[model samples]
Target: MNNVRSKICGITRVEDALAAARAGADAIGLVFYAKSPRAVNVQQARAIVQALPPFVTTVGLFVDASRCEVGEILDALPLDLLQFHGDETPAQCEGHGRPWIKALRVRPGDDLEAACQEYVGARALLLDAYVAGVPGGTGQSFDWSLIPARLSKPVVLAGGLSPDNVAEAIAQVKPWAVDVSGGVEQAKGIKDAQKIDAFLRAVRGA
Candidate 1:
């Protein structure tokens, strides 16, 4: 119930990021994909990262970006982790000078073991619902039964996770951590502090 780390994703504002940190988020995600409504550029991300207090993990989310593109951002950002939300090869996710996670859009009958093995380099595996044409932030929940009881790597359960259902999710999936974006937001790229506090409270109380 307790010690289940939480990440507030799709942060676009310094104040919102600070709110998440103040609300006890173990990590805060900064989206980098240009097409995403929650995406933040270098200047924006830099400011947000700078504003965060100690021990809050800074995650950079990228969607099938090129190595050159990732490298460029790596040079400028102070990200502690990378979440690959697209079909990036293990090698592509590697050598970015930060620990990385691989996000798999889970669907029925998908070979999660193989995928985990393939991305063996990832510190954790982020499992999100499979929504067509949407890399992430769709606020969709996947069937928890589909996830194997045990995986080679830790599972960062995502998709449609909010304070309302997260308690049930933590009981059912027992993920190493949980990630929420739209669930804690007032609008796209805008987080609600009350929602964030409620969500973290639920996580701790679950």
Candidate 2:
């Protein structure tokens, strides 16, 4: 079994996907929201997804997108999982037949347990730091104490994770997996290959 799984999100180019996969990423994310600067058109996403090597899961992220939009993207790109970053109801998240992961924007004084309870059927819960008026991809982390010791589903930690501190974060949280976007990028929508390799090596060591 993979010891410390890692996901590289917001991939926009073929080279980036290949770099992430070579760096040992367990999965890679493709942003489908048109509003996001990192967002990829259906054709672009399809090409990138097709170029990815075997054994690397592709995750499609949406922010309050309609079922039809999600379906079309899924048909276009062979994504392995769906991630809801906006305020999507459980009904909406489950409406798609594919397994889904829900993003919980961690905020001060937030009840992590209660939030996870709302999405009980989610394949996994991704805990990310809350950013006003932004649909994630923010290089900020929340307080780890907010996460409860016992959760019903797997927890995939995200937000501000980098090679510098990923080991400490994993040792403390012990999440089923960890995800990174801006942390491994040189700038928004641009990935740094060396950073990707370093981040993966750190997670592998954990």
Candidate 3:
């Protein structure tokens, strides 16, 4: 079986980004959402990107941001992927000339198959926990049984995953990738090297 990939989201500092990379994270996420405690500006993003080693995908995350705003960030640095963590339609997510993924908060009564069909153009689908009015970064997990056995696109499981439970999550969900933000953090935007290492180790062991 192919080892599940990992993405360390909401990376702020160059050190944290390096820590994740050294720990064998396939990707690191940089939040562009202003309201997020982990949000990073063009300068911060650039610095983090520049300090990283080769072959590490840099993902730019946004939450209901304007097209212009996203464009400006893309214009500033090289974000290998875009993560739309808000209510962006397929049409709106398109035209960026870059590969993108849609984050859907899993709530009861939601049709995930329809969402997969809706964002058919996405490279993958990210499933997160649903918190009323909160887009993501909720340390609380949702029902894993909610995910279907099959979908049109690859699934990148998120929501409250940590070192202790990631093995079980990967074994159960069997997602294409796993995303973590607050799980490995020492603070809101600061990552603990030990936690990051342990998280990656757990994913590998899983």
lDDT of 3 by residue, 69-109 (tens): 99999999999999999999998899998999999999888
The TM-score of predicted model 1 comes to 0.98
- Please give the lDDT score for candidate 3: 0.95
Error of 2 at 173 (Å): 0.7
Candidates' RMSD to native:
0.8, 1.4, 0.8
TM-score of each: 0.98, 0.96, 0.98
Stretches off by above 4 angstroms in model 2 are: none
Evaluated at residue 144, the lDDT of candidate 2 is 86
How many Å off is the CA of 89 in candidate 1? 1.2
For candidate 1, write residues 1-206 as lDDT tens digits: 47899999999999999999999999999999999999999999999999999999999999999999989998998789999999888999998889999999999999998988999999999999999999999999999999999899999999999999999999999989999999999999999999999999999999
What are the per-residue Cα lDDT tens digits for candidate 2 across 1-206?
Answer: 33978999999999999999998999999998888878999888888888988999999999999999999887777788999999999999996778999998888887777767898879899999888998798899888878888887889999899989889899889999999999999888889999999999999887
**lDDT of model 1 at position 121:** 92
Better of 1 and 2 by TM-score: 1
Task: Spell out the clash pairs found in candidate 2.
Answer: none
